[model samples]
Target: MGNDGHIAHLTGPRRPRALSPLREHLRDTFWFAPTAGLLGAVLLWWAASAVDLEIVALLQRERAYGAVRELMSIAEDAKTIVTTISAAMMTFIGVVFSISLVAVQMAGGQLTPRVVRIFVRSRITKITLTVFLATFLFSLLVLTSYESESSAREVTSVPVVQSLMTLALVGLSLVLFIAYVSSTLRLMQVGPVVDRIARETLRMLARQAPGSEDGGDGAGVRAPETGWMAHEGRAGVVRDVHVARLVRVARRQGVVLRLIPRIGDFVMPGTPVLAVHGGTPPRRALLRYTVSVGVERTFHQDLGLGLRQLSDIALRALSPAVNDPTTAVQCLDRVVQILAAVVHRPLGTVHHRDRRGAVRLTQRVPGWADLVDLGLTEVRAASVHSPQVTRRLLAGIDDLLLLAPEERREPLVRHRELLLQAVEQAVPEAADRRFASHPDRQGIG
Candidate 1:
């Protein structure tokens, strides 16, 4: 049974659409935002230059010597300022992001490689980079519109509007730079990174549709075992399934399709990706479109990914070389929080039915026990030597047991016993064993 909930029988095809490959790609890349910013900078410069020309022409026709003189002086000052901005903006972007990346790399090495994904997906980081690049490009374009022939006394035309726009961009970039630096600094810290991951995981949990209580698989309907479709492409992790489209295709074909691998599972070539029950299997191409595969796992549809990342951090922290028990305890705190949220939620196989109430698509999601194990088991094993971690692990398990239902308490109980036994075997001193045995939320404290 999947940890997400019991078998869900969802009627009709009203499920949320999964993120398409192109969108997912765009989300993960750094180039898209800067590229868009560059394009926007070009368009903005053109508009500002046009407006500046119009203002200059009006000033000349009206013979407004006072306004023209003032504007030309502003333009003269702006020329020097914009020139400096254009020259320095690129360097600012390179230096800021370069340092940020190095910090990110160090953080990744210290915690887990998966944390880098958080940095990549940060909106502030992307927006900051975009504005910085756009400011640079806009300033450069504004410089081109400067009137080289105009002397200080006889001002013909001034790039007044363009210069103002350039100044505005520069100010915006400065504000974003400060914000970006603060955000990056927080990302490097253990508390903020773990909190971010836990929050994202809980959001995914909240989005999950409630599952039915009828514990039977497919709500008493049996999946057909007639035909199957094998994956044909290069091996990749199952990122997301376009369930709405799959159900539509299944309903049309008068068949029930069961996905063989759960989300986050890697599929090698020739792996059976879909099982066709009730009728002929749909074309391989159709199945391929509905199931998105990638080289790595994403949080898009994989509910366990957040927990997996948290576990990785905990294990890394507990390693002898790092031996940061407090970091491990922090991770355990989040793990318990995630499990507490999952305890009451229904999780298991999900059944998607057509409008007629027939189960057309079925998927196995992570179960409650699976989640408890994923979040705690590995961390417990690695915490044997650290009394601080052991105490925290016991406290976390005890906390979960208080919230977990009877059926769900088994995993928590089992983990508690295993934790005690491991602590006993590893810590030979009775006083230390007693210390490790006692549950403490703060570990040592």
Candidate 2:
């Protein structure tokens, strides 16, 4: 069916559990690991210094003079060296942070706002921040033990071990800073970002379609005719569902638990988020915990989000103020590939059950047709004026129609007609209309 909402709740086969909010947040947040790791690093260095201080003291007490004698001057200057390095690193961190924020802002404006999440979740960005902050902490800790003196040194043994380690960390951070700069610069480019979005979409397609060539159609007991509609307790996007747990609870209660909101769907307080059929409605607490809601949609299980992201990029490029047709064309290429993958793959559907095959969970997933509408309809409308965008749109639709089954033809034809209508509106001349309607990868005659 063309309508996603038309798919009624029904039971299906069981699936896996989803990550806890705390765990998912830790994974999504850019600073969590780095911040935690920096603290750990500080503790580790402090412990090392504690142990090494005694070793160095013993050597000094014995009037040791071999290798130690050679670096006595270096040790003497350790305080000044560590302090300078710490100050420079902190300053560098401020500058880099400011620049990165600018890049994020530019990307948010130029590309899709969702893409900003990509840059924020970047491993390199997180690592760079961690290194710089850690280096600052390291140098500061080393400075605490910096022994200064006129007659006798205020510090003992210059904390030589700590000095060397701090220097090493500083050097490593420098290398990472250079790499981070290169990565952030690359992120600013339109081509790489479009490709990345497309790649992630394709990856999700593969993940959602894994296991068999069979349709992802789930079969289970019909949802009870009468059921209580469960409303959302909080406002947020339905990020993911712990399906296994849902199926288990539904089976235990001998009822069909129809989750109302699909992953990626935005829900607010009082929105119908679930449908409880039979068996005393599973505790609202259980249902709420089973469904993971968040402020923003994530790429974790929402394949449509990735397509929406690419579509947004294309739309932004085609905007009157932007008017970058070439970028739109580039985005369309990825859209074409994503649609083709969808046609050839299995889409996640509601049909989860336990080992006994008794259907306990009936979930509503955006059907394949719905995804096509999401990925193409908006971009098609936006890019109509650009011949390149129009032609690519036709070609993408042609490819999808070719791969889709006979049952899906009606929806595909409707989409094709919609594209033609958009083409007519965009191109005044018959010759231009004829050229735009023709499906071609290059987008124009």
Q: TM-score per candidate, in order?
A: 0.89, 0.84
Q: How would you encode candidate 2's per-residue C-alpha lDDT over 65-153 as one tens digit per residue?
A: 44445445666677678878977887888888998999989988998788987887678888888888888888888777655452222
Which is the leading candidate under TM-score?
1
Q: Report the poorest 10 consecutive residues by lDDT, candidate 1.
A: 1-10
Residue 423, model 2: lDDT of: 81
What residue runs in model 1 are displaced by over 4 Å at the alpha carbon? 1-25, 60-70, 150-157, 211-223, 353-358
Q: What is the lDDT of residue 251 in candidate 2?
A: 71
Q: Cα RMSD for candidate 1?
A: 4.1
What is the lDDT of every predicted structure here? 0.83, 0.72
Q: How well does candidate 1 match the true structure in TM-score terms? A: 0.89
> For model 2, where is the 10-residue window of minimal lDDT?
1-10
Cα lDDT, model 1, residue 105: 97
Q: Which residue ranges in model 2 land beyond 4 Å of their true spot?
A: 1-22, 57-72, 148-158, 209-219, 223-233, 251-255, 355-358
Residues 1-445 of candidate 1 have per-residue lDDT tens digits of 1221222444555444344555766888889998999999999988888787778778777877778778888888879999999999898888997899899999999999999999998999999999998998888888888776664346545888888898999889989988998999999999999999999888666555554445543443465577888877789999877766777788888888888888899999899888888888777666657777888887776889999999999999999899899999999899989988878877787676666666777777888878888998899899999989999999888898898888888988999999999888888999989988999999998
